[model samples]
Target chain A: MKKYLKYVVILLLIPLLIIAGACFYPERSYAFVSLIAVLLSCVPFFLSFEKKNNSTRKIVLLAVMTALSAAGRFIFAPVPFFKPVTAMVVIAGMYFGAEFGFLTGALSAFISNFYFGQGAWTPFQMFSWGIIGFIAGLLSSPLIKSKILLIVYGALAGVFYSLMMDVWTVLWMDGYFNIERFFGAVITALPVTVKYIVSNIIFLIILVPLFEKKIERLKTKYGI
Target chain B: MNSFKNLNPYFLISYFIFVLFISIFSFNPIYLTSGMLGALSYCFLILEKKNILKSIIFYLLIFLAVAVLNPLFSHNGKTVLFFINDNRVTLEALIYGAVLALAVVEVIFWFKCFNLIFDSEKIIFLFGKISPKTALVISMTLRFIPNFIKTFRSVNTSQKLLLKNHRLKRYLNSFSAVITQSMENAVITSDSMNARGYLLKHKTFYSRFKFTPTDLFLLIISAVLFILTVIGRTSFTYYPEFIFPDLSLLNCISYFSFLVLSFIPFIFEIKEGIIWKFSVSKI
Candidate 1:
């Protein structure tokens, strides 16, 4: 109960603090609010992982997963907006717990950006993918049991990721979070959004079975 | 590492944070100009000459795009320049858009320099303090990516040799085969880690980011300047009406401070260049 209580408090406090900040500093508040909120949300998972002993194996395996996904980018470079990274991240989440999944998602984005140039969009990508993985972990049982459910979730995750990134696009262009501008940004990026959705669904459908077998085997053999 | 870039990661991060904070939060054109000039100057100093023109063009394109798009969303201020879809595209909104555009562009420029200075080792050094395993994971992933690519290529080649046709099927099989191979490798790695008696506690981190007097001097300057800039930025408001920044003594001094803060890296680089020339001539 105490262990869970800490995260509940943090999750609750973030919005309240952002609201207060926005009230005091309107011009700076939107970016400030978004930045602190996303970064702090990962703190609970970071702290939990930090205290554990025998963390090296988990660390190495997590790194392996992140690398595999990043390498997926190079493999799929011929196709625009079609990478297996999202599929790999979702697979990692479904087998591992939410904490591991979030870190994998976050770390993959950060590490890959070292090769693909980090920008304002980097944090937004990290946050979006991290949330997808965290949600995948939470919904793993349902997703694992039904292939149809898995495909549906994959499509939804792609849409969610695209929409979330568009939010960053709008925020970066204007000084504040403008609804009209956000809609405009979304409308302009519709074709790219479609590509994102199609790519995610295709990768998830194709890669899920193969990764599932490998991950399941590892889990049983090494108690991962 | 170069002399200036070799500052402790914390100091470098602090300096960037202050500039980013001011740039993102303050719509005051003065602050944005200070941040933009300082950022572009540093970027030009470090970036390749061929790429400099390309970067400037990119900056201008984004600037124009943002300025045009701003008034469509925001309907604040007087001096209506035009109307679009029943919305007043005010001149003030255009100015705000330009300010916003400058802030975003400035951040992109600074990050280019930030990425140049803070390599994976600095990343590990920084994260190791707060979350050691996370740092380890990041560094290890950086190492494993190339190895993963090699395995993928080998698997692809083997698939080519086995199968006659069906390119899609061949690629798919190679991807899955690589996954299987990586999993087995991971399991073996865990066992070896257990055998090695990886200590429960020790200096797992070994970063060469040493702090010197130069770092301390830079830190003090950034802190003082950051405070001054923030004070200047916060006193003026940009919404509901267009209020020009008062040309008070305090504003002018703070504006100057912010310029110095932003240009610190560029200034340091030039000073170092001059000193190096002197030493080389003597030799």
Candidate 2:
């Protein structure tokens, strides 16, 4: 079980490495660079020579998880509610570990844009989502199993998402980059931000404990 | 395809540098317009036929909007057309805005073409001389976006299933769930990568591409053009005062050549497209 877990973790790191490369090449569109990186990262899982270690099964599961996470943005969009896809990445992180959480968060946004359409903004999406998952991993302790702690972390994460998203928005938008205009932009983004925060609170309050229970059961069954 | 084949990655990089330099030192309307036209024509000829019309329409709308609005907002320039509540609407502002918009659109169009021609592999090859750590971070960031989005959705849906009413409340609950889950995943990924020696000092790419004689020739030509363009644009200024007089056959030829060079990539793509069509017809 530990060995399998180790493999799953390795699979998650591939996307982050790709993202790091794309960030350096400013000549190319961030979206294009990131997309190619995400696609290439899949090569290891699909083409790896190791067949006996249940690599295929794990790859399929990760792929499905990645794909589902990508679709979360376009299908439901979390317009006013919680960003649905972010929730799954957070949960995945809690159950899995830091690396899985990071990739799940990052790749979910990267791959989804292929269908929704790619743009200059895709990198920001990758960074924002990746950070969210990364933070969750850092915060998660054994105490994550506590119902109240889970709910609080979940709420904090939702607010974190909103803050990061807003920061990217200000960076992308011209006038908002200046301190004078920053307040106005922040005020304008407040409603959406509030919505993001509130939705996250709702998700964490209900889903954290349930997932915690499920993860505990899985760990016990697998003897991890 | 052959045109671009003769023009290597070096040419593209040099051309980009040339454009940036020219944009700073030279701000002539005529020059900017000509450059934009050259880029647009190149892109139009090279890009997929279906996309060209859409881009053209988008550009036209933006051009018109800026042209019409600039006169109202900006009261600069010598050529005045009319007055709005005693504030003069300058023809110069309108023209200048249109040209600026065109320049922006053209640059964006060329970049799109650049993206189609150069994928991640080429980028890595060109830029790998720099720090690998930075490169790896960029690469990882690129792949992370789509994957993160997917996980967010499944988690949300599962949360929704548990909460029937009070939609706002449901969202608040779900938010926390998503954050916690994603973090857990990130940790696992980090551990896995570390275990596999991903953080080692000497990392190698799995694929390889070689530079040929053709590529070298193209690079030399691009470097020369880039240097010449920079010198021509920045060496002297025969503008505003018009003391030395601006119009010269040499200047026109150089400007025209530079424009042509920008389109080489697009031309190559068009050649490939024609070949593809021919092959399909034969099949």
- Whole-model Cα lDDT per candidate? 0.79, 0.55
Model 1, B17-89: lDDT tens digits are 8887777767667877878888778878887877988988988998898777778788998788888888898
RMSD, every candidate, angstroms: 2.6, 10.7
Docking class of 2: incorrect
Q: What would the TM-score be for candidate 1 when compared with the true structure?
A: 0.92
lDDT digits (tens) for residues B68-155 of candidate 2: 7545544657766778899887766666556546555555565565555555545545555543332343355446545545555566
Candidate 1, pairs of clashing residues: none
Per-model TM-score on C-alpha atoms:
0.92, 0.55
Every model: iRMSD: 1.8, 10.5
Task: Compose the digit string of candidate 2's lDDT tens values, residues A79-166.
Answer: 5454566666776666656555666676677556555554445665666666567556666674375666666666676666666555
lDDT digits (tens) for residues A66-159 of candidate 1:
9889988887676678888888889888887766778888888988998888876787788788878887887899988999999888888888
